[model samples]
Target: MSVNVIILNGVSSSGKTTLAKAIQKYSHEIWLHVAMDSFIAMLPDGREFDREWFPMVEVSREGEVLPQMTNGPSGEALLLEMRRLVRGLSETGFNVIVDEVAEADTIADYRGRLGNGCLVVKVDAPLSELERRERERGDRLIGLAREQSERVHNGISYDLEVDTHAQTPDALARLILERIAA
Candidate 1:
């Protein structure tokens, strides 16, 4: 089946965003990149502790700082609209690339939102590599990768699975292209 949307599902810091950009850069067809973070960024004033915004990170008894951001109302509304936007874009015949941290609920939601014309790709890396990347980036919550690494793919299935720990985004994108073309 032909698809207009590609969803890259993975934990934070797994390079889904980089892969999406690489796919856009190299693809013969132009695609619009829609990232879940783009909606998160729309939260007013970037509030973290509002409990209506991102609600801040949680700490475990073992001193693990986990940023398990379950969106409060405002964030939820934004995400809902983002999914709708993706659906609308694909319906309009635009090729779309989605960079997402797919938890169980959103995976199911995306299936309904993106319709039949979508490809879900599992983007992943080892937890160690993910943590390293997160620390190297220094812009994300310290434990987001650790927190999400275990849960992102729990209930989701994908058309392709790619590991990014030892590869560049461009190479990975080429692999995805070749596999899909097959």
Candidate 2:
């Protein structure tokens, strides 16, 4: 079977993971859910991900262009690895559902490195609504929101935009399926 890589990106509380789960549930193919954040969190040695480290390594003098690393791992090491995993999975004929921030730099990296045969899905929610959800979910949601806000403000683009502000996960999944069909 030809691999279909589904990428989910968006602001915090955007329901990317939720959408990924829905896709896995509805898709007839053997879909694999790969989450960069979850993989990084699973890293051994009990090392917590340093959120502020990117702006440090990736910041530039012009402010016009925040620098991005081309070296191993770059500022977004986990994401880079996730992209690599996607490439490998595609090569192996596995349908992959990737959930990440999908920031501009990473998207460029993916385009340059991963080639074609993939779908980019962007999930979005109002900042205020996201913030409220963040406050409600506490640490996990708050951290996710912080990363998502930074990514979106930094200017990220996608092939499909899914707004999950009021829709159920199943509804969002149906929308994504229809988009993919189109």
Candidate 3:
């Protein structure tokens, strides 16, 4: 049997990781979870503010301040490489679940690069719920959900849209499995 790829896209704290973990735990196939956060974490710290490296800027919207990470040249290259790595893994017969924030261009890139056999899933939660989750998590920068919620799914379409606020991760994973099985 050929390997399959599932791309879980959503804003910060929207439960993509949770759903990915649930899928890995419940699915008979051993799915490798490739998270953007883990790849980003691999980058050296203290460069997030450097324009030539990974520049993150603070922007205010509706009286709330948010940190927006700019995909500068370096960041863009890293993202492309990450996408390629995921594709390569899948080509090598490894099932892959990619958890990422779906920026418009990034979605397009994945669509073009991965082509068929890729199931794009939108893991969603209301902006208010996302903000609450972000706060509760406390590991993320303040207002990241707000910033990402505004832009992450722009111009992206999905085979499945799961609402984390309404569904538990395990339930969502089952739904995803059913969809893939059909």
Candidate 4:
């Protein structure tokens, strides 16, 4: 049987991963969470040291702030790699939940590569709520908020759109399940 691929896409701190995990926990579907952040984090030393992927961040150590590496690879490259993984997983009969900031073009490209059975869900929240979540998540976004807003408007349309600002994970998961069933 072919897997039901779901792309839980949204701006940063939109709770994509949280909701994706909830669906995986509640549903009987054989699913995999292909997190871009974890993918970037696991690169080998040679690739990890490359300036193109691993950028330096000024991190706090005691009273001092020092540079550290964060956000490996450009967003485009990361999304492409994620599409490749999704295609592989779907071919192997595993439903894939991709929690990434995939652009409209990337989504279109991936849809072609993964075939028509894929479901794209756009998880969104109020900008203010998203900002608070971002702060709470401890991912120093810097200028990403502005970029996220712009991309959300421009990104490809989704099969489902959920405003997760006030709903619990279970509620959101139910919404997703209902859509998938429909």
Model 2, span 1-182: residue lDDT tens: 22278878776567888889998888777689988667656654334434422322344333533323222344456566678988888788888888876567777776665566677777877777787887886654344464446545366556777778878889988887777667
For TM-score, the strongest prediction is 3
TM-scores for all predictions: 0.91, 0.76, 0.93, 0.78
Best-to-worst lDDT order: 3, 1, 4, 2
Q: What lDDT does each candidate get?
A: 0.83, 0.67, 0.85, 0.73
lDDT value, candidate 2, whole model: 0.67
Candidate 4 local lDDT, 1-182, one digit each (tens): 23378888787778888998899888977678888667666777557546667565565545655444444456347657778878987887777888876677777887898776688888888878887876787854643543465555484877778888878877998888777777
Off by over 4 Å in 2: 1-3, 50-75, 141-147, 150-154
lDDT of 4: 0.73
What are the clashing pairs of model 3? Answer: none
Note each model's CA RMSD in angstroms: 1.9, 5.2, 1.7, 6.1
Cand. 3 TM to true fold: 0.93
Q: Whole-model lDDT for model 3 versus the true structure?
A: 0.85
Local lDDT at 175 for model 4 = 81
Candidate 4 residue spans exceeding 4 A from truth = 1-3, 44-51, 54-78, 153-155
**How do the residues 1-182 of candidate 1 rate in per-residue lDDT, one tens digit apiece?**
46888899998889998899899888898989999888777656657447876676574635765767677787777778889999899888898888888787887898887666788899999889999999999888888888888677897777888899878899999987776566
lDDT of 3 by residue, 1-182 (tens): 33288999998899999999999988999999999888778777866547865688899888877899777787778878999998899888888999998677887787777777688999989888988888888788778888988888888877789899998999999999888877
